[model samples]
Target: MNRRGFLMTASAAAAGFALAQAPGAAFAAPVRKALPRLKTQQVGSGDINFGYHSAGPEEGRPVVLLHDFGYDIHSFTEVIPLLAEQGFRVLVPYMRGHGSTRFKDKSIARSAQPEALGADTLTVIDSLHHPEAVVAGFGQGAVAARAFAQLKPTRCKGIVAVDGLWRPVPERAALQKDRRGFARKLWTANSPDWRFDEAVFARAAVSFDNPDFAAILTDTPSNAAVPTVSAPVLTLRGSASGIPVDDPTARMIEGAGHNLPLEAPQAFADAIAEMVRNAKWRT
Candidate 1:
């Protein structure tokens, strides 16, 4: 199907499905009063200066939360505190070409390949002096999380991926021509249940203004490799998302959309917590 046709079908699918929840089924929302202000920090990681938000105790079990495409660290604003309360040190980083993250070397290509992103993840973990971390990711961030696990399984305790692991689009030029329009369509199609205001979108949209945004989005590695992930994996999908489930063990978050972290922060954090409790790491 053509792009237009594909989008139409996806939007319809997103609108048609409603989460089948039992009566009185509910999840806890993040408490505003208990939420602590996340401290912003920067780390020099290879070619990139990574800017990230850190929360919870310094010695708490590490949990890295990676945001999806078209979003930044702010995507997990509510979710971070909940994990922190559970004694997990949460680190939400702005991906390359997003927010305050910048490339240090001018000659280096601005690439968002799985390998590049995975390397960045390792840098974050090493910067914190942690042996291993339970990594959680949303959308494109999920791809990164998976990449990190494959690249360095020993350093990844477990993985929580939501609506991730999609193959790259073949028509890169066509999509690159209208990045913003394409992003808007994806938002509407994948999150039909979400009624996000312009203010919320604008907050994340500003990250797109980075000079390397277009280059990173359009860059496609010739050999995009996916090694086997040995770490325990917990896959998730939003009830109303248009993305298909590739993992048989994937759990559906009730009443959520494509932006699972934003729409269901409680469920997202809970999944990470569960992975941390269940996954066994090599000693």
Candidate 2:
């Protein structure tokens, strides 16, 4: 086999191992240990039960950090401490189909579309009873972050979307139909970073076989979404990542990619700090 063929085969295996998904199927989710500082708690919102980790000063400025699709609250283990020490109440919740967060009514739709994620995020924000919060998200979570910022501007004070917004989110309907193929392609392109960071998420990624990949991948981006964000917004990505940067507040870090939180924690933290500093929140 040629170099390209060899590379393709390797990537397919890695993505298969990492995401554990079939074409148009849910990703698998792994079990994870609880953090000492992060209190494990659940909030019943509407018919959904959201399990999340929370720490830091409750009276301090609130910040809600959402993890990428393949990860859970544990994703922000490193960054949350920093913000907490700096007097920020950090809340990291599992997405709809990841971790302990779940829908109370099985009869309800399980679609993880951007709109659904946006609504769920709002539920979390309201349950926490934070009048407003600085919302930050990575990858799929970033899309959720954008939706939250646009749809719930009154509750979302500012948004810091790293490797999430203003990027080329490929709309491939076929990917949903062939999730395994999508995993192969995605992992092939993403394995280099995965190899370096799976340790942070792998064991806890048991449910990698369950997230709504197709609905997420093929979900349409609303043309009117960006203009609706009344709160401040900051878009960021790694310089090495080919993802686009179209926002005025867009920023970049050298040699980073979708896994910016792990590959560049300091830079990611810096970006969040910058977002909070520039946010037009009430004093």
Q: Candidate 2: deviation at residue 85, Å?
A: 0.7
Query: Which candidate wins on lDDT?
Result: 1
Candidate 2's displacement at residue 152, Å, is 2.1
Task: Count clashing residue pairs in model 1.
Answer: 0
TM-score of each: 0.80, 0.72
**TM-score of model 2 vs. true structure:** 0.72
Model 1, position 42, has a per-residue lDDT of 90
lDDT for predicted candidate 2 compared with the true structure: 0.60
Clashes of each: 0, 23
Candidate 1: stretches off by over 4 Å: 1-39, 170-180, 220-226, 281-283
> What tens digits encode model 1's per-residue C-alpha lDDT throughout 115-224?
78889999887776777888998766877888899889888989888766444443345345755544555566566667665555656666767777667756634334
Instruction: Single out the weakest 10-residue window by summed lDDT for candidate 1.
Output: 1-10
